[model samples]
Target: LIISSDSRIPSCGNSTLTGLDGDFVRRSKWTQLIPNTTEATAAAEAAGSSRAAGFMRLTSHRVTIQGANSATLQVNSGQMKMGMTYGFHLQVFNIYRGSNVGNSKETFLVSVKTEPVIAQIRGGDDRLLPIGSLTESKILIDASLSTDPANSTAKLNYNWLLSLSSGPTINTSSLQSLATEQMFFTTVPFLYLNKSSLISDSVYHLFLNVTSRRRGGKAVSSTSQVLRTTSTAVPVVSVLGGGIVNEAIPITLTLSTSSPSPTATYLWECTSQNLILTDPTTRSTSLDSQNLQILPSVLNGGATYTFQASVTIGGATGSASTTVIVNAGPVSGSCGGSPEVGEGLKTYFLLGCTGWSDQDTPMLFKFSTFSPTSTLELSSYSQLSSITTLLPARPSNTTIISSIQDSLGATSSFMFSLQVSQPDTFDVQDTRDLIKIRLTEGDSSLASVLISGTASYVFSNRSIQNTSQQASTVSGLVSLVDSLLNSSVSTTEAQVSTPLSLLQTVTSGPVSSLTTSTQGAVLSIVERTINSSLNSFSNAVASSTLGVLGNVL
Candidate 1:
C-alpha cells in the first residue's frame, strides 16, 4: 500500500487539528501474494531442515473517504512505508507490506481560512466628537475593530493607522504622508493626538484606520467616522501689586485676565511666614474671589510671601504668581542726659539720640527745664539731630527733663539740672581810695564811684579827738567826706582845708601844723573855732564853713 500527504490542506479551510476527521482514508493499491515451494524449502533448509514448508499469505483492506472537500482530514496507517508528493491536489496515502501492518502511522490535516475580515470598528466613548469644544491639549482615541466569526482559528495581525485632516474632505495623499502607525494584538487600539500640532481657531478631523491581516492571506481594513477637533480660548491671568512692603501695612492684590471666559472659576492662594487665613471654600490658604486682602500681621517682618492666582474655564486653566517682600518697622532709639544744670550759664542738655533708620521718618524731640522754666519741641531729619537743648539762665540749679518720640511711637526720657551761683561781694577800700583822690584834687564834682575788684567791707564808728565838741566836729566832718565820696562829684582836700581855715579864724586860735596823725585834730579844732566865731563875727565864717560841709554832705 502507498500513502501520500498534503501540506496545503490547513490553509484552505477553517478547521483545527482536534476537529479533523481522523477516519477518512484513501487507498491506491492492495497487497499481492505468490506461493513458491522450492523457495520455501530453500528458506527452510537455510533455517534448519526442521522448518516445514510455509505458504504465502494475502490480506485485503479497504479505506473510505468522508465529509466534503472543504473539511479537514486525518489518516492512520499500521506500519506503512510513506512517500509524500506535493502537487495541485493535496494527496496523503501510504504503501505498506502486509506483514508489517501492525505498526502505526498517523497524519492530521487542519483546514484554516487565513483571510482576516474586519467587519466594523468600535470607537470607544473617549473618541473626539464634533459636538463640543476641546479644552485639553491632548486627546485619546480608543478604537476597537472587530472581525467577523468571533471564533475563527486564524492568527491575525492588526495595525492602527491614525491621520489628521483640517477639513471635511480627507486628502488620502496628505494622510498617507502624515499618518501615525502602530501594531496591536487585539481588536482594541489606542491613539493619541496633540492639539498643538493642529491650527488654532480651526477644526481638525481625525481618521482611524484598522488594518487586520493573517499570514499568506489578504489584509482587511476599516475606517472610523470623521472625528472633528475643536478648540477653546485659553484664559490669561495676571497679578498686580507685588514687591517690597512694610509690616503692618495693608497689602492688596488683584487678579486680572487678558481674555475673559464665561464659565471661568477663580482661586487665589497665598503662603507666608507665620500667617494663616481662613476660607469658606477651602480650609487652607485659598480664596475664591479675584481680589485678595492681606491685613497687617498677615505677613511677618523680614519675610517673603508668595501668591498664586489660577483661573479655570472649560477644563482649561491659566495661572499667574507674584511675591511680596515684607520689611521691618523703624527701630527704637535712646534718650538720656546728666542730672544737674548750672544757672547764669549756657548749658547744653542732651534731649535724645538714635541710630540710623532704614526709612526716612522724622523724629520728635522735646525739652523742658524747671527753676527758670522753659519748654521746646522740634522735628529732626538726620539720624541724630536737635539732640541738645540750651538753657540760658535760672535762679538756681535745677533739673532739666527731656523726651523723644519716634514715628513708630517709641519714646525715651532724660533729666538734668541747672545750677545757679551766689551773688558777688562788694569792694570798699577801692572806693575809699577813689574818694581820697577826688578830695585831694579839690574836684567837688567827683561824687559816686564804681568800686570793683576784690575788696568788700563795712565801716564802723571810731573817736577822732578828745574833747566832746571836737569829737562831734570830727564825726560830722567824716560823715560829710563819706557823703562826698558817695555822691557823683570830685572833691579836693584844699576844698576841705578852706572850710577849716574859716573855722580857725572864728575860734581865734593859733593854726596847728597838720600832720597825717593829727589831721583829725585840725578838723576838730576848726569846728570848735567856727562855733565860737558864730557869736563873735555874727556867723559870717561859721555860715561859710557850715555851708561847705552841707554842700559836700
Candidate 2:
C-alpha cells in the first residue's frame, strides 16, 4: 500500500503487511490513503519474501521530527464499532532516511486510551488502544487492551520512543499520526474485537482523522472520512415441510433481519438431485401455474430436495432456505374404458367434485380381474388414483374395461384401447398396420358398422399416413327415401322428349344467365309434365293424395 498527502509530507515509497486475517476483522469496505494501494494488490505484495515494503504501504500516515517533534493519529468511532470494544493496533517497520531537518531522535505519541464523546456520535481519537505500556517500541494490542476515551474520564494519549542511533529508527508513531510532514514506512494494524459483541445488521457511516502531539504541546488533524460496519444483515431462507415426492403440502418461509425496515420478496429454490428444472434463470419463487404446474407423471424416486427463498427490503436483503428428503410413491396409469373388456383390464373417470378428502388425495381401487399377461395402469385424463402397470413402454397386448362412480351415485361405463401392435406381427422387410380405439361409451345392442372408408389422410415430411385412422367417420348421412325423392326431381328422369328437352333448357343455363323467354318456356313445359306424371302416378297409387289434389286445384 502507498500513502500520499497534498500537504508537506513527502510521498514515501510503498510498504505491505502479511499474516493479517482480513475476514475475521470486519466486513466494512476499506480505502487506502494512498490511491495506489488496494486490498488485492496489497495482499499479493505482502505475501512476497520481502516484508519491509508491505509494512510501509499498509500504514500510510507517519511522522518523523526532531527530539520534541511528536504526532497523534485519531481513529474515530465512525471508522470503527460504536459500542463494541476494539483494539486499534499498528506495526512499526521498514524505516528510511527522513527528508525533514530535525533532531536525530524523533519521539511520537498515540492515544492508548479512550477520550470523551467529542462529536454528536463518539469519535475515534478518543478510543485508541495503547501499545506495549505506551513507552515501549513496536507493540501489538486488541481494542480492549487500552481504555476507551469515549467512555473514560482520562484523555486519550500514547508516546512512541524511537532510537535514531541506527541509520534511522523505524517511525512507528507515523502509523497513527495525522501530520504527514515526513515519510515513514509502517503498517496500520486493523482494529478487531478482543471479544465479539452483537451488532445489528445495518449501514453505518463514519470517517478517520490524523493528529500529532508535539513537544510544543500543539496538535494537528487530517481530512479523511471512513465508513464502519455497524452491523451486517445475512440472507436466510426457511422451508416448512420435509419435502415429500409427489406429495402436495403447504410450504411457508420466514426471514430474520438486523434493520427493522428491510424491503424484500421471497425466492423458492428446489435443489433436488432429480431432474428438476435445471435452468437457474427460469427458476423462481412465484407459485403461478407456469412455475408450479407439476404433472402427476414426473415424480420417480427418493431424492434430496432444498429450496431457498430470498427477499430484498430497503436495500437490505435476507434469504431463508431448508433441505428435506423427497420420497416417491407408486406409479399408476389408466387401464381401459367403456365395456372395459378383455381378459383383464379396467378403467375409471373423474367424478368432478368441489373438494377431496385427505384420504382421497391418494385414492386406491381394486381391479375386477387380474391379467396374467397385462397390468393395471392409471390414465391421467380419468383422474383415478393408485393406477399400476408393469410395462415401461406401451404393451403389445394391452386392454382394459372399467366403470366409474360419482359422488351422487351415478355410474358410468368406459373402455381402454388395446395396444395396436402384436409381438410377431412385423419383421424388418414386412409392414403391418393396426388401428386402436378406446370407447368410453357403447351400446352393445347396436350392430358394428365398418366406417373405415371415411378415413382421411394427411401428408407431412414427404410421408402420407392416416392421422385419424381410428375415427373413420363420415360428415353427413342421407336416408334411402330422401334419396329416391331427389332423383325424381332431376331433369335426367323426364319421360316425354319435349318435357325432357324443355327441362334441359331450364336447367342447362346458369340461374343468373337465363333470359326471361327461356325461363318462361321452361316453366310452361315443367307444369304440363308435372300434371301428366301426377295423374298417372296417382292412378297407380289411388289411395295416396296425389291425383285428387292436382285435379281439385
Candidate 3:
C-alpha cells in the first residue's frame, strides 16, 4: 500500500507549510496516518474471533518517504494468507503534529483492506479426496471449511468454478482466462459435486470465489482458493439381487459395471454349505430349488446365505454382497391322519393333529375329495384348526388330497383314502319311530346311550331344552356313533354277525350327559307316540296266528 501526499497541502489543522521544488519532509516529520476505522480492521477482528489463531496479518509495516511530498506505506503478508482486496476508501489524509487522527496516537490502520472472505476446500473425510472410492463411483467436494471475517450475519456468496486441465499453474491476476468448464453459486459455505461431473485419470482445478458486503454497505471483501482433486476417477461396478424366498425355491443374481476393461473378469461365491452356486465363474449365477430345511442335528440350520460378486473394471477390482432369506417349508405332522368317515350328515372330525409352517406365521389347509357326488361341508375356510370338520353326504371311496399352506404360498401336500360307508336308508318319519321304539321299548335299552361319547362335547356348547332340541341332538349323536364305530360297515364276513362288537366306543361309559329329567322327557315322547301302534300290532300278531311274527320282530 502506498500513501502519496500532493504537492499542495490539501487540508489540515497545522500551519499551511507548502512544499516547493525539491523539498520533502523527513520520515519523523511525516505525521500522516490512516485511522483504524477501515474495513480491514473489522476483518482482522472477525478473523481472530472465528478461528483459534490469526488469519489476517501484516508481517511488515514500514513507511518510506520517496519524494519531497509523497510517501509509500508497505504491508506484506505471511505464507498462509493469500487473496487481495483493493480500491476501497482507507481515510488517508494529511496530518500535522498537533492534529492526530484519533484521541490516541497508537492506532494507525493498515493502508490495505485485504479482503476478509477466505475460501477453503476439503473432501468428505476432512482431507482433499476423490473420496467415495472406485466401486460406488462417487466424489465429494466440500467448501464448508472456508472463512468469512465479516459480522456473523453477513452473507458470503460462494461461487465455485471447475476447470479441466493438464496440471497448469494458476495466475491470480488473469483468472478470467482459467477457462473453467462448470460454474455455479451456493449461499452456504459448503457444497459437493458427484463423479459424473469428473472423469478418471484426468486433471482438474477447482476455484471458489466468495464475496460479501459489510460495514453498512461501506466495505466489501471478496476472496478465493484453488481446491485439490485427484487425477483418477472412481471405478464403477454394481451387484444386484437377493430377496425373501421359501425353502426349495430357486435364486438368481447378476453382476454389472459401466467402466469395463479388456482385463475385466467376474467371480461369484456363496459361504453357505447348503447353497450350490451354478455358473460361479460367470456374471450370472443361480441356486436351484435346494431344500433349505436343515435337520436339527445340522449346525445353524442353513436358513440364510450370503452371495458375493466380484468384478474388475479399468484394472480395479471391487466386490459387493447381499443376503438371501430362506424360510423353512412347513412341516406336516403326519401324511394326513387316517380318520374314519361316514355319510349323511356325518362330519369327519380330523382326529389327530394340525400342520404348521412356522411359529410366527399362521397355517392354512385345503382339501380335495375326488368324488363327484359328495360335497364337503367344511367347518371353516380350511385354515389349520383343531376342530376342522368335513361333511361328505354320500358314501364313496375318496382319494383325499390334502395340503397345508402358509402365508408365503409354500405348501406340503399328502394323499389319503377315506372310505365313506353309506348310512342306513331311512325316512325321517321311520327314523323317528325306530329310534323311539329302540330307546323306550326295544330289547336293547338305550335311553342313556344317545348323549354319550363325542356328542357330550358337542352338546356342551349347545342349548338343548325341549323335545325338538333333543331330537336334533340325537341325529348328531347317531352320526358320531357311526363315524366312531364305522357302523354302517357291511360285508366284513359277507354276512350279518353278532352286534355286541359294534358301538363299543360310542357309548361314553354307561351314562348320558343330559339331566335325568331331560332323559325321561326324551324317552316319554318316544314311547307315547309308539305305544298304541305297538299294542295294536301285538293283538294282530296274537290273534292272526301269523307265526311269521318272529321274523318281523
Best-to-worst TM-score order: 3, 1, 2
The residue-by-residue lDDT of candidate 1 on 1-553, one tens digit each, is 1122222112235656335434334332212222233533333344453323222221122233322132232233222111221111122342233222222222221112233354333321112332234455554544433443322343444454444445445554544443233322334455554545544433444444444443234556554444444444446566777666666656788888755766778987664424445633323224877787776555676676667777887876666666666766544544445334432222444444444232313445555443221221222233333344433333345454555444544444555554533223323344445546755664432211111111001111221223443433333334444444334222222233223322222222112212233454445544544454223432344454554343222
Q: What lDDT does model 3 reach?
A: 0.39
lDDT of 3 by residue, 69-148 (tens): 22323333231122322212222333455353321111233323334554544321112233345443444444554555
- Which regions in candidate 3 have their CA more than 4 angstroms from the true location? 1-235, 258-265, 279-302, 313-316, 332-352, 355-357, 369-401, 413-417, 421-553
Candidates ranked by lDDT? 1, 3, 2
Winner of 1 and 2 under lDDT:
1
State the TM-score for model 1. 0.25
Please give the CA lDDT of all the candidate structures. 0.40, 0.27, 0.39
lDDT of 2 by residue, 43-159 (tens): 435445464343343333422312111122334322432222221222222222432222121111122222222111111211121211123232221111222323333233322
Per-candidate clashes, comma-separated: 47, 70, 2
lDDT at residue 494 of model 1 (Cα atoms): 21
Off by over 4 Å in 1: 1-234, 261-263, 272-274, 279-286, 330-333, 337-349, 355-377, 389-553
Record all residue pairs in model 3 with backbone atoms less than 3 Å apart, i.e. clashing: 24-68, 200-233
State the displacement of the C-alpha of residue 86, model 2, in Å, after optimal TM-score superposition: 71
lDDT of 2 at 459: 12
Worst 10 residues of 2 by lDDT: 444-453
Q: What's the TM-score of each model vs. the native?
A: 0.25, 0.21, 0.29
